[model samples]
Target: MYFGASASALQRLVEQLKLEAAVERIKVSQAAAELQQYCMQKACKDALLVGEPRSCALF
Candidate 1:
């Protein structure tokens, strides 16, 4: 998953899902270029978590 700002953005997303305890791993990134590369490498086709519905298409 990619968060726009800081790790807190990811934290909030986890909190929203109420799956904090279920999450076994977490990776945080603020660099847009790095995030884009990571996502592309992972072949991430969709945003699993996002603050806004419209942002889902970003993945």
Candidate 2:
């Protein structure tokens, strides 16, 4: 579960839900990079944009 909130907020939510060991938070940039890499590995021509696999706007 990638949260778009502050670290403190994410922590609080995790604690509230008691999912400390189940969920992990990552930066948007890192997630985007990973998504792009996975897409490339699968040869997704439209992974990012039409005919532009490298031009991702994931952020």
Candidate 3:
């Protein structure tokens, strides 16, 4: 029973990680879209976008 439970838990954990990674990709793409929109606005206002921009660097 313990072995079965352990295997089940491990399978669930793997599934969760896969889901999280998929969600992370969605989030990073969203963030990049937002960042691009922001930079475009900033550029329009200042002619040169500048700042310690946010990172969307994935693991």
lDDT of 2 by residue, 11-51 (tens): 88779788656679999999999998998877755543456
Candidate 2 ranges beyond 4 A from true positions? 1-16, 44-59
Candidates in order, TM-scores: namely: 0.25, 0.41, 0.33
- Whole-model lDDT per candidate: 0.66, 0.76, 0.73
Tens digits of per-residue lDDT for model 3 on 1-59?
Answer: 44657877988988998998887455878999999998877785552344445564574
Off by over 4 Å in 1: 1-4, 19-59
For residues 1-59, what per-residue lDDT tens digits would candidate 1 score against the true structure? 48466899877977978875676654555466678888877664444532345643458
lDDT of 3 at 8: 77
Which ranking of candidates, highest lDDT first? Answer: 2, 3, 1
* Greater-lDDT candidate between 1 and 3: 3
Clashing pairs in 3: none
**What are the clashing pairs of model 2?**
none
Model 2 whole-model lDDT (C-alpha atoms): 0.76
